[model samples]
Target: MRRRAIPLLVAAVALAAAALTAPAATADEGAAPAATATDAAAPAAGADDRHRPRLYTPAANPEAYSQALDLARAGLYRDAAGILAMVRTPQAVWFGDQSPAEVEREARQVVRDAAGATVVFSLYNVPGRDCSGYSGGGANTTAEYQAWIDAVARGIGRSEAIVILETDSLALIPSDCGQDDAQGTKTAARYAEVNYAIDRLEPLKGTKVYLDTGHAAWHGPASITPRLVKGGIAKATGFFTNVSNYQTDSANSWFGKLVSACVAYVGEGGDAAQCPHQSWPREQADAWIAANVRTPSYQWKHFVTDSSRNGQGPWVPPPGKYTDPQDWCNPPNRGLGARPTLNTGDPLHDARLWIKISGESDGLCLRGTPGPEDPERGMVDPKAGDWFREQALELVRLANPPILPGS
Candidate 1:
């Protein structure tokens, strides 16, 4: 579910007052205007793109990129470059509110702009999204969602891409969240919508479709495998885990392997009822897989994990601080996880990591408190998708494997 935040009217007023007190400057204060054709163009800035795998770069993250440049001009090179590097990594482009034509056009442009490089696109138009809570809106019905997905498929039009189909669609089922409406209709149209997307997208040349499986911390293999099967995982390229959440890579990878093994088990006519869970001891789980799952790991359903924000693992709230910690919501001290890469060494692991969620955005943390500010941080968190300056800086500074020079 999407995190919720309280309004920060007090902070807004303070910021307004500070802005009024500051000295006035020209529109292009820090950087000069672009040079005209008559003037020789300056050399293009150097970027460390060689080692990085080709990921779809969004047109630009204006606010975050601008702030990074300002910091660079101020001689904060480490901080500046860190932010700049993040923009280079491929991130998902969500197509929720677009018309069929608009969505197709946008998708075609994105794939074409990628220039044959692999890009990730997220389809998030499931009806009754988020149980009608935060991030509530989606297509009004399953048919609408199918049409939207069809437009997206047409947009890609044979371009090589990875489609992360309908985040939280299966993981946050109504039964799990105590809201049967998530099932959509008695017939479970949610599964139908997903299957439709897979059928439409999987046939496209060079396209890989990955259904959402929530995170390791949320659903175990036994629980999610049946959902994946029902949602048509057999036809998909695979599934994705830990999207937009902060779960350690080891945990996610382990969970993914279990889920994959379970899928294979069920495919072989074995009962998922007897599959080992994430809670089982590692040795026990491995033993079970070795004995029961006859398929090669690579031949089994592959999976990828969202390693965008799990570097330092999850944040630990001070004991007794709040009645409910809401740890996943824009938690403090969390660092950037591993950078995006295709050569993950493990065949079962299609990719080591991905920026499934944009790192610069906030998570709408409320921390179980009511009111105008996040009680835990004593500040109002930014709404979901808004640029989070402080969090961005923190991610760069504490990045695991370090977002280093030329990296």
Candidate 2:
């Protein structure tokens, strides 16, 4: 029965067909080029003038954008925008393995393209990234990683941007992931590298740096807060949660608040060991916050969450289905979460529930299988960073806010 279910799911995805890759008129053909930094630097057209977060549409994703235009031209306006919307919002552009010169040039280009609007840049070249897992490959040494981060900082050059530092750098540590001391000592070096990044990037005139904390599902507030503090959350604007993972906004938000409160509590001479965990009831948590967290929400460390692919929340593996579920990997039936916005009502929650991880990319799933193909899906998923058309279409189809005509 389980084997039969896999084929059906794959068939449904297959229906998207060439539409996923169809070419259409250029974006400039129907739409004007995005405003330049000079134009964006000018005074507001209205009293409510503010710098809009710039969505850096990658040239690599022309197929997705072109397909959306085709859909719109075919009068499928909602469908078209649903697909195009991902590109229209701010998503993190990762910098890894590139030289100081190369990363700086690329970073400047993105900031210049934003024309002074806030753009998200993800720094992902930690010393031992991904714990030597499928997404492995980072800087070979601490000195190399620091130099890379310094280059990234120089690239921004006081431009307005939010730097999402090192996803999984803190969440997956050497102790847990069995990372080697190939360079004599990597675990300690990882923490030092993150701190170095914060030191370099946080002082930039217009930058906001947020370190990554795995997700609500993985690390509890109690366990993750100390890690954040040690990783230099005090110097950063705050920390980020749920980067590239599927966890609900509610869960992520709550978890973030708890972490924020913990940071504040510890900062004010309180103990993190005594702070309330996410497992506690809402009333109890609130009471704990009121009693212990004396600082105002604004004064506390704020956090942002990645709501990229969590509309249906985390995947629940079928009972006894596989030896290793790898639930965090590419799971079936996941949907897009909230659109990016700066106006989160909660003060502790920062602007932009961003697509920290691009939805177009595949999460290589092994699922305890010995072979290359995922046993559950019965297919070899695309390597990380490769476009996954089936998953992209699924995200559009299952968007929670319902990617509609006006929405």
Candidate 3:
């Protein structure tokens, strides 16, 4: 599912106005966002890659920038600066539900905005997306989806772009969500659709397409590896995890390494079931990788992780509070995670991204309750892709790296 906002001009104008009214820097304020001590000290995973692309920061959501102005007017300069800093950070621009012509035009405009920097694109609108859940709705047919993807490719022309092919397309297939037929027609179509997308987008000289592998918490590396292979991982740059989910960076990185190793092992005639998963002891898993997986780091499938809202890690529900906790849906107290960076300092890991637009609602979360209001928050959450002001404020206040410099 993808979050959206009002038209581009309105958001641009609102963000500009808010930027003008934001308080001038004080002695305590720093010029740019300051990385936490933990981040500054973390080992470089892929520091050898001296040519990693620069990331592009797209325009902010209208409501979010407007909220910054509102806070500034209310004499909360720290919060206002935090919000401004957050929106100014680099993030993805999603494309979906638009006609091929519309998408092509919009994609071209985004490339133009980026100039020469690399832009991250979250392409939703796959048919049967979300299995008709809260953020459902996609192209009506397979042909329509192919046409849409083709348009996106044409829009990029030859510019640099990292296409996060489709979130949840592999992790939660039609069969997993019970949306498949007895003969599995929809599931097969889903694979073909993903393959088609990879074939279409990955060939562009300036484009690198990545498949979806859910998150570290959902599917184990061994379980998702076979699916990635079937979905044409051999053709894609690699796969991404933790899109729109709250999982720790360490967890995601380990999961990615395991999955890459498993893919290589399976490719070398080993069974995916026999590979080490995230649950295995780290010492044992590392030992296994050393002994069995012989693929070079450059040859192995690289991965990107979403760090938009995992600053506080994941939320824990009170002991057996609800039948379906829906922990993934709008869990409270989640803060913003690491800032997007290509120089992640890991060989297997590519980058840490903010794939899910921070501050957007994750639909109406009931948490298995019967009330119209969310039991945890005492009010109904906004619709799936709408702006969530309360959650936005919470994210800025609790941001792990600390959105403000000295806060």
Give the winner by lDDT: 3
Pairs of colliding residues, candidate 3? 44-345, 45-345, 45-346, 45-347, 46-345, 46-346
As a whole number from 0 to 100, the lDDT of residue 390 in candidate 1 is 77
In order, what lDDT does every prediction score? 0.72, 0.72, 0.82
Q: Best candidate per TM-score, number?
A: 3
The TM-score of candidate 2 is 0.83
Q: What lDDT does candidate 1 reach at residue 336?
A: 76
Residue range 1-407, candidate 3, lDDT tens digits: 12342243244434444554443221112112221111222234545423435677777777886787667657675676677667766788899889999999999988887767678899999999998899899999999999999999989889988899889999989999888889999989999999999999998989888999999889997789899988999999999999999999999999999999999988888889989979999999999999998777679999999999999998888988899899999899999887777767898787788889899999999999896888999999999999999898889889887765555
Candidate 1 on 1-407: residue-level lDDT in tens? 11221123223323323433331111111111111010011123464444334555564456665666556556565566566555544566777778888899999988877776666787777876766665667888777888888899899998878888878888886555555654346237778888999999999998999998998888888888999999999999999998878899899888988999999999999998889888899999899999999888778999888878888888888898778787777888777787665656678888744545545555567767775687766787777777777788887778775654333
Residue 103 of model 2 has an lDDT of: 94
Off by over 4 Å in 1: 1-53, 73-75, 181-187
Quick one: how many clashes does candidate 1 have? 0
When 1 and 3 are scored with TM-score, the better candidate is 3
TM-score, every prediction: 0.83, 0.83, 0.89
* Candidate 2 ranges with C-alpha deviation above 4 Å: 1-60, 63-81, 180-184
Locate the minimum summed-lDDT window of 10 residues in model 2. Answer: 23-32
**Candidate 2 lDDT by residue in tens digits, 1-407:** 23654354233323332234432112211111333211112233453445443344333365565555455556565566556555544466778868888998998888877666667788878877888777788888888888888889888988887788888999888767766556536667778889999999999999999987899988887788888888998899999999888989999889998999999998898778898888899899999899888888889898888877888899999898788898887788888776665556778887545544545555678777686887767788888876666677678778775443223
- Ranking of all predicted structures according to lDDT, beginning with the best and ending with the worst: 3, 2, 1
